[model samples]
Target: MTHETRSSRRNFLAASSGLVAAAAMPPALAQTAPFLITSATDVLLPKGKAQRVVICGGGWGGLNAAKQLRQLAPQLEVVVLERNPVFFSCPMSNKWLVGQVDTNFLTFDYLKVSEKYGYRFIQTEILAVERDRKRVVTAAGSLDYDYLILSPGIRYNYEAWFGNDRRAAEATRARFPAAYVPNAEHFRLKQAIEDFKGGEIVMTLPPPPQRCPPSPYERACLLAWHLKTKKIKGHITILDHKDGIRPIGLGFRQAFEELYKDQITYVPNAQVKEVDPFNQRIKTAAGDFKFDHAILMAPHQAGDLAWKAGVIGKNAEGKPTGWSGVDPLFLNLRDDRDVYVIGDAVGIVSPQFLFYPKAGHVANRHAKIVARYIAERAAGREPAYSLPDNLCYMWVSADPQQAINVQFDYKIGDFQDKGKVILQTQIDDNERRPELIVEDFRWFGYMREDLFG
Candidate 1:
């Protein structure tokens, strides 16, 4: 798409003041607009060479945010800090673990995205965030910014499982890889699966609020499919902490029963009490289970940068919440307005009713909102606040080419004794069509192009 086309799409939403009340808008208007504007306010422009936006983490949220910010305000300097030189997508990476697709299909060069989008990309680890000084200290150097955007993703909560023994946690991670992070873990798990001759393969699911809600189930289904197709003599066991699969419970339940009932065993509400990697045994509240091979999806928390910066901590109720508190409408830090938090790092405190899932598509949508907000503010105009929508698809089978989809819309509601934002979800699972599999590739392509191309 041309620069003009991209700007026009963003401007269309900016020009429509009535889009703020999108819940009551006409169907025609709602269908065309991508977000619902919530509020607007004028602000004085600061004196500088050009407003600078320093974005941390070059994944979906940060990349899209930098791209859109440059498109909206060509004069502004957009800098991205990412530790990884190459970008690997977590979405659809389960296919790679199951040997359905090559790793190259899910990896991209950061230099290409930087060159195409005209943004400065730095491959350096962020050491600390000096919020009061408006600068971030990195392993390379420190950089100041007028506005900071954090999409630092998440970190595994290993302490929750292994206490203060870091070595034990690392050893356990090496034994049973969690491929959810989209890196070497993918290959580790894939090799283990390929080398397995027979016996039982175990996979554990962490509590909710993880990056992708449907991912564990998707992995289980695909692994089961792999076992049956390859004629491997093995049974796959899924241990979930929740009472049952959720968000798309009905769809996954049907898949387990109708297709892989014999090859897969699902045990829900099986909370892990102890993990004995030395003996290849997992002791859970329900019972102790042994496995020939295992994959443990550890509990998740915000990246350490957020915690070190004091951006995420206990809430008013003194409960430890491992995310940064942000204004739901604009995604800016509630305590420090100049800093914005997006993607999986966004946290919700008590009595606040915002329910945005930590998914790639949701993060992509957040990038647009933050980009618009910064662009309008720099131009001495008040940008209307907006809420993002989510579109997600999960693959169930490769041979049969079947998939499931979910779409969600959010709207601001009255702040009575309820959450401030309301969610309306629509799911398509009645018929598992092969066309959805085709659309799955199309969706990934469109998203990548939208952010990087």
Candidate 2:
């Protein structure tokens, strides 16, 4: 097919109704499965009024579960707790930031979702989770539930690395903001690019156990492409914490050599010790350096709520770790009897890398399992939880027509292995799969719609 024809086809695949078809397909075909490993039969489904599911965070996991619960169990009451009224999608958003896609399309309103899904939307932050009482206390009110799903997502640890350099954050917010959180920072970052005359533009990668692991490199590459194409001068520096690169490090190397070339510089094992916003200098393990603009993607965690609730695993000294334990289906680690945890807030990593990176796709898939389980329980039946297969796609627009993907599956309790099966597809420099593009569009759209549509 012609390029235009192929683009059209992919767009069609990504349209609203296309999600049902895409979701029905196996991960190999969809190239977008999250945590689809081994399937679990209906063994531990809960029954009747015994299940009151209160999902926290209106992001992918909680929102997806809320939608599924309403669809599968119409009589069961579901409440979604989200601090934001609209969700600004992180996937495909980079395209928008680079002026490829419009910014408006990336924004989805939860009010529409509240109307369609018939679920309660409490715009409040969760202060604490009383698991013993089966209750959650928020800034707005206290909610009681039989089952709880926490998907509050990852929180950046600025104090650990930044120290007294709080101004570094402000400087970043004033310069190349880390739009990873999707708000004013996102737009501000875009504007910084628009205003840049181009000097040393630096982007740092966070340590592991952070959200969207591959995203930093993707962002750096895309930004470099934009700078090169726009003929902006100066070096595009990527400072990483580890001695090596990221998850699909080899593939990324291929991508870097083929695409970014000398436009981007790689600094390995160069951890940023501290950043001086006053002088715009970043002190790293290697040494100190100054930049015209910088973005520090810091290490992240599950935040204070998990610690206050005594849910997240504690260290030998009883300090809170990043996340709580979760099963294959993302149920709570402490008491899988009735709770579910999803997204970066979850601690269980599939040995098969099925649910790696904690991306939006993985969160959505976990939502389906949690919702299905909740629905089954409401009907006085046992709910089964299954593993999710994940297909992660990276769009490097230097060669805008193509995309690269990594696919994997997970088995419960096998988070350390890559399972026996791993699937991957590289769309090549010029090859275009309409279905893949369609899957991308549909994936983000459905994710937005299903969550905050």
Candidate 3:
């Protein structure tokens, strides 16, 4: 949690619209500028006074890399550039939206992490990346990196799929907000729930490759639990874009049917096309749903930042080849060994058993391995990434006790055993063990500190 003062660096001069100096550098070549080299792994420090490692994004993946790199490679200078002063944790946000927990509990300060972790924190937007020069461009200045780790998370594909209603959807986000980030969305959704006298409430799930796959269902169930407890006479319906719940369909079904069936209605293989705010109805592939409140978990893609930066290449299909590639090296343009893509940004191969969707836990784990690998290559050593394990808990209701768990262990290269089933647990009303609730809180706390805090 140690904070470092921001250092001045030259701006990345983009030679042309698309190309840069770093991207043009050969992998074997080394820069003459200032750099640091570690003893054990030969991690290259930023050139000159300190070896610099620049990490983009301050969420789970970025923060984890910053913390770990500062600890392991103490000599290397670490800098984290984030656009926000405070980060909102989407993990425990559902509780806040339902009036069960305070919004303050879901918000965390980056100062603690910056002050203690020896990471220079800058609050700014990354304008672009000069791959050939191995530099990052921001409104403030440009940053040269011995190695770079990119983990900007996911973005809503509102423009493509949401279409002309994008603005209206964003406007309605205040009351029937997606509650995705838990700041604006949380407050708006909270207000909507408070004003509700009791009617139909719908929460829709989009297609795959979203930040949190089980979130919509978990959110729907949590809201249903809240309404039932408040004596609100309303039915909670979850309109899913996919045919089933997710990779662990059986576990999801068991949780809904056995625990929340009374208060919730599950609709799968549904696609919501539009929302008539005036009529209070949702138009979808299945049919039209009239509800008092509607929550659309819109489709997503790699953050717009990536698309804007020209980092995402398009195929013949006209779809931006962000992480949709079937290869682990998707979007990995390693010019001069300067740039490294991890987390939701990079399209890693997914095993047929369970699709590798984006999640905070997975992103955090991915960042560590990528950070270590980048650090190794900086010191003139070969880079190697480790296997990543994913763990996520879906809340069944606001009871804080009922939940479902799915765990995965993935190997880096082998697509067949990429994801090995670890465990899946369902928590029923009768099985609401107090110890598990305590465990869940403890896990979330560790996760918060490791990621956002």
Candidate 3 per-residue C-alpha lDDT over 340-407 given as tens digits, one digit per residue, 9 for 90 to 100: 56667665354353335577777777777777776666666876545566776666655656666666
lDDT of 2 at 116: 67
Question: What's the lDDT for all of these models?
Answer: 0.78, 0.67, 0.65
Please tell me which model should have the higher TM-score, number 2 or number 3: 3
Tell me the TM-score of model 1: 0.86
- Alpha carbon RMSD to native, model 1: 12.1
Error of 1 at 97 (Å): 1.7
Off by over 4 Å in 1: 1-48, 349-354, 426-430
Q: In lDDT terms, which candidate is top? A: 1
Segments of candidate 3 deviating more than 4 angstroms: 1-48, 164-166, 313-318, 322-336, 351-355, 412-435
After TM-score superposition, the amount by which residue 176's alpha carbon in candidate 3 deviates from its true location, in angstroms, is: 2.4
